[model samples]
Target: MKKLFYFLFVLGIVSCSTSSDDTLENQQNPTDLEPNKAFVYYMESPKVSSLQPSWYYTFNYKNGRLVKMIGKFVKSENIWSPDNFYSDSFTTLSYHNNKIELKFSNDTYPTIVYTMENDKPKKAELYNQFNELVTVKTYTYESGKIKIYSKTYTLETYYTYYLDSNNNLIKSEKLEKSGGLDKALTTTTYSNFDNSKNPFKKLYLLNDNFYEKSLSNNNYRKINYTIQNLQNPEYLPEIGNAEWTYQYDLNGQIVLHHPL
Candidate 1:
């Protein structure tokens, strides 16, 4: 049941929120940060990491369309070693006219059908294998931001993206509601951006709706969010923050992320 929920969570069914971070000075110059056209090749898993939003994905595209996205992730807040373990998952993308479908590995149900017009994603729908539940997400894009509204039978999530001039995510705010909109369950903020070209910059052509593996022009420096859904304030978990430093490839693109 835990694994079942985890799979559903990744499908943007259980939760759909964007990400942001605070910045420290980037080691690379703004001009030098101009990234080359590139594809994500790999992600290094640190032996110890407590990053809140932790999974990383490497994507493949053909004819300017996404073909596949493979995820590599460790247990949250775990000290990974020979004794501990990690896992991976992947989704395959198939494009149709004005729409693209992302299917899980070896599954027909639990897929995301993305609708695009003029190559910009307008809506996405997630269907269970039984087709019993449909989770829908609608998008609105502006010069420096992206807004997403997601709805399921039980809840709704509103996402506001604040971006840099280069269209990199500067901050991400999300509001979740169960009965009706009132207060947010959490607020996420991102800071610190390196000028290096994002490894997955081309992914913006597909979509920028996900928070964990961002499709921004630059790399996220940090992620901090506080949960507000708890009834007992004293029992609320201490949600940790994620901060990143990066390594650059030859073409001035981010090659790897080091959590600080």
Candidate 2:
């Protein structure tokens, strides 16, 4: 549950946000599916032929809070590397208080740092290989939606979210500002929740990251299917009309997700 996918869609490119840190003190306990270790197989699609190299992630916790994640890619039969293949992308994570930092073996910088308030994400800081600050994003919550503003040395963008009564994020809209002019970019919507589950809830709670808000106190609840609609397609054409199905383990963590 990297949450990389949703973060890619909504955040686009931005930095981090910061706010009060006691927001998550009363949050519900994590789901039974919480993983100390897991494997994720990357595939282009559900078809067997689309299976790609896999990744393994291990988590470490301190006083019941997730404090670290280690990830490494595992080569599959499709790879034709030499007898000894060396990967330059082994990743490591460090979590302290409400902040989580990521680093890769191939990177000279700390990659990214996420800061959370309560159980909600407030900011994210992106760094280059040299460890220099590249971008920052700040988030503010109003009503039931979260407003995000991202800034970099070169550009700035804004995004808004609309949530359902359950606090599950249902829609997102992106906007860009240039020379006092504001332009709409895209509007994305999600639907067909499975029961009361918001699939990525546990990831958000423990990882100190936020892409969507959940209303359920139980992280074990699962989203069995989801449909995404895009008002204006840009990079992801399939999102304009796509359906996704998720399968979970006995512990309630997702094991497989396929498009239908």
Candidate 3:
């Protein structure tokens, strides 16, 4: 079945690798969902409607190469239907780590053998299912970042990302050549995050066209909190009015998250 409404959150995915000795004491990897640190993604519409979901994606850190990537998909209700699946074909690629190797389903006569240099792909010999050489792809790098130089194939489709100063991807463009003109499905900006103060703030979807404005964007609402003077700190009405609430698991995973 085809996957629909599958929430995906990609954060802090860097190109360079750090030394093993420079690990943080209580750092959160892509997989960790603790309250102190968590994964967050906001799927927004062109008109400013947002459907944000917090999800986790983990990578195995053995020998500087990605070994495995795993995570889960959660929602308040079962959004997957007969025509839609919550998950699709999962694929992973490795760079430097040698422990985790790639194994094709069938290797009797391999179709492609990718060559690597410094854990980065240098060249690949492509072949059809019948073992016929189809095409090849060469890679380039810019300041330790992998760049695709060219694809020696009959038809080539490419996708690239443009990041902002915050290291957040502000734009993504897909390049494809068809019968005539190039079609670009562009998604403009919707929401903004203030990384200085409160990290976990309310995410507002800007427009109503791309999202079901009333229901989708209103999933987060403000709340009030108070600490009684009898047992805890005195209740401050102003401070209480600035809080918000959402359902989360013990692991700090968002559960039935919606505005109260």
**By TM-score, who's the top model here?**
1
**Can you write out model 3's per-residue Cα lDDT over 109-188, one digit (the tens) per residue?**
23445565553346666555586766655666453123343344444534343444444433333344334334322222
Query: Which regions in candidate 3 have their CA more than 4 angstroms from the true location?
Result: 1-65, 69-101, 104-153, 179-260
Candidate 3 lowest-lDDT run of ten: 202-211
Order of candidate numbers by lDDT, starting with the best = 1, 2, 3
Show the lowest summed lDDT stretch of 10 residues, model 2.
42-51
Each prediction's TM-score versus the true structure: 0.64, 0.58, 0.34
Candidate 3 residue 130 Cα shift, in angstroms, is 4.5
Q: Mind giving the per-residue lDDT tens digits that candidate 1 earns over 110-148?
A: 588878655466988988888664788999988787888
Better of 1 and 3 by TM-score: 1
For residues 16-124, what per-residue lDDT tens digits would candidate 2 score against the true structure? Answer: 2222222232232554234554433321111122322343455555444455555534335445542222233455556566776666565444477878776666898
lDDT values, one for every candidate: 0.57, 0.51, 0.33
Clashing pairs in 3: 47-207, 48-205, 48-206, 48-207, 49-207, 219-259
